[model samples]
Target chain A: MRGEAPRGAPNRLDLHDLSLFAGWDPGGRWRLFGEFELGEALVVREGRLRTDQREFDYERLYAEYDLRPDLKLRLGKFLTPVGRWNLIHADPLVWTTRRPLTTELPFAAHASGLSLLGEGAWHGGVFDYQLFVDDSLALDPDRGDRPLAGGAGMGLHDSFDHALGGRLHLLSADARDGLGASLAWFRRRGEAADRLLLGGDWHRRRGRLVLDSEAFYRFGRSADDWGGFLQAVARIHGGLHLVGRYEYIRSADLGAEGGAGLLGLTWRFHRAGVVKLGFQESAGPRVQPDGWILSYGLLY
Target chain B: MARGAYRSQVGLWSWPILAVLLMGISGGALAAAPGIAVVVHDPALAAGLDRASLARIYRRWQRIDTAGRPLVPVNLPADAPLRRAFTQALFRQSPEDMRGFWDERYFQGVSPPTVLASPEAVERFVRRTPGALGYLPDCRTPPDLVVALRLRWPRAAGIDPFGLCQEGD
Candidate 1:
């Protein structure tokens, strides 16, 4: 459940979602995994229930085949492996309630197609890669979450008609520190411009302190966009963290350019549950409006 | 001018104090416990395993061994003293600190190792199941069970192949 209250807006609460996941390993090289979500099940405005906002979302449905101990093949709908955050963006898994604009605002969050993933030890570090392609219409895409840019239909925050991309990361032996890069090329619906996205991310953990950052730029004809954020989480005590982030984003098409600063507290009360309280201040064009946000997430 | 000098002096002293505090919290308890032994099924395989491999197996970073057989690693309950010692020695992390890692793995369809109720139960399970691996206090490992790596007290010194310990620790 999540509750939000902007400085001047009414306090609102909603039952955010219930996610069901299933995985089967048939004792062979083949495996199956699927995720289904019932989202916005209930919404309350000031004090009344809002029925118009309820929705059911199909998040992911995929099958995997183990080509070898170090390599695997996956097919169907899955989260795009652009950066580390998006792969583990579940509310319980991430540090903040607000998603970084750089991770999701520039591209679709999910892709339906095929992917190849592999990992191996190199020197004293580990190397990992994921390459994927999406060439057709997405399956059951939730277009409502995507917002408009300029006056074009399905312009910003929309799925690609065709996309090809890959991400590569090199990490310390313990997987506690790493740096990665991503590159992708795609075309938008009803537009003739070709877009190329370049991204880089890095994270390091030492004792009770962790620092993470990412930057991305999408090159398109008359619609260039770029953004970046650096975040830090320092452990104050058991399960309690002091979180801070600074971010800036610019979109030529929407004529929006701004930055935001956030300070928050995250408490992992249990292994599969987390409660977050964040207060944000933004200048313009924010993904999540500037406000106080309190969210509780649990995995059953 | 005097106040600025005093503030700079305090800032200089804070780092060493904080460093010592962090060290004491992360490693002090493990220094009091006995050594931990990483064990597997085949005795010969013990000679080939290294500290890096053990850390990888437990973290679910490497699911299969060099022979392409799936590795099944087990653990004692989270609160077990021996489990804390092992986690601190291998990953330099507390059980509480690892919850986020396991949660991310859970989201990716990979689960943490199966946890047994006690060290005895872990020993019994590892003895019978092929490709099984587990950790226990050094003295509890019988001759039949193979010791892959012995993480002794004073973890900074690194892996102790001989499994040596003092009378009490």
Candidate 2:
């Protein structure tokens, strides 16, 4: 599948991926995968609100590769290997709103990277582990104007920054009748500022019930202090999801706590799409006294 | 004397009728299919798999085998009765729900298992593949395959609109 390229299309780049996955038995080693997606969004980053009116992003690229039964390595930009929600994307999640004040504040959600992932079992349960490294662009500096505990300015400092992180996950053999937990960490070293992050999530689902919670702590020595946040999500029915969160931040120069309470609903229109709506109330020294947000999201 | 006669006569007919009804019920119960076998590739696996373990393997949870081979699960064609039986006994979710489940995994960079055309194909594939696993009807013993678990349709029946497997037998 790799050799087909549209000729005379010099500006059109040809990209492909080959992945081979096998079970313990030889017969399960069939190769499968291919797809391409075009994504675009427009964002107006001004004042307190960041709105995307028109923009284009390559949300996914189709490719293939398969070698060695026991290991598989993917080469391309994939979703950032971070918390549960970020890894799974927006569609399959139970909650309507993106994780509140805490979950979205810390990490970049997607990156171009090489991912090495494997799964096996030990101690009578299933285990999945992954290690990945990526080259990423720094966050736009103008996006870092929030009042953090330790005054840290956010923006691009250099061009050649990179990040590395991994996750160790454990689940019971039964997907619906098991517990899943993971630990992840990442760091980016830019010419002017460096950033470090550590985070994890604990999740459980049984029958119609689901529970998931995650925490992240970020530190960098560039301009301000260290900050982190914790977010939790619970699903009672397939339709209604409840969320709660807390955030604590310590600047290199100052120490304070920033926190919020979030209650939300994520209604799945179908498995591929969903509608999310929520309310957030902040409670902390450095929080928006009357800050509330409304958002709509989609995944396809 | 009259009261005693009336009581005796009522008891005589009631016992005879009840006995006949009980016998008829027992006959019908005995005629039903015996316990169904959950077939796999390794005969020894029959000893290790419980309802929970078998459920996990079918759901693509425990993908690796005890011997370190990755476990690939094969399914019958979308309309097979045996496939319905296996999925009903295992996932409790409908085929549509199962597709949605796999879609989530796919977007997350996980691939779903390959689907085979028939039970014969599954048996042939599993026999050749070391870590491949699939289920078939318990009627015949195919060569080179194992029986992993036994499943009985629950007595308390409900139309599982979502095709989710009932929990814990």
What DockQ do you compute for every candidate structure?
0.22, 0.13
TM-score of chain B of each: 0.70, 0.70
| Model 2 docking tier (incorrect/acceptable/medium/high) | incorrect
Query: TM-score of model 2, chain A?
Result: 0.62
* TM-score against native, each model: 0.80, 0.58
Model 2, B1-169: lDDT tens digits are 9999999999998998999999989887655444346666666566667765666566554555555455667887756655665666565544654665676665655656678986668778888876667776555436556777767643322333122222212
Per-residue lDDT, model 2, residue B55, is 60
Error of 2 at A48 (Å): 20
Q: Which pairs of residues collide in model 1?
A: none
Docking class of 1: incorrect
Report how far off residue B79 is in candidate 2 (Å): 9.8
Off by over 4 Å in 2: A1-53, A60-70, A92-94, A100-104, A136-160, A176-196, A206-209, A222-257, A283-300, B1-73, B76-101, B109-111, B114-133, B140-169
Give all candidates' CA lDDT scores.
Answer: 0.78, 0.52
Counting clashing residue pairs in each candidate, in order, gives: 0, 38
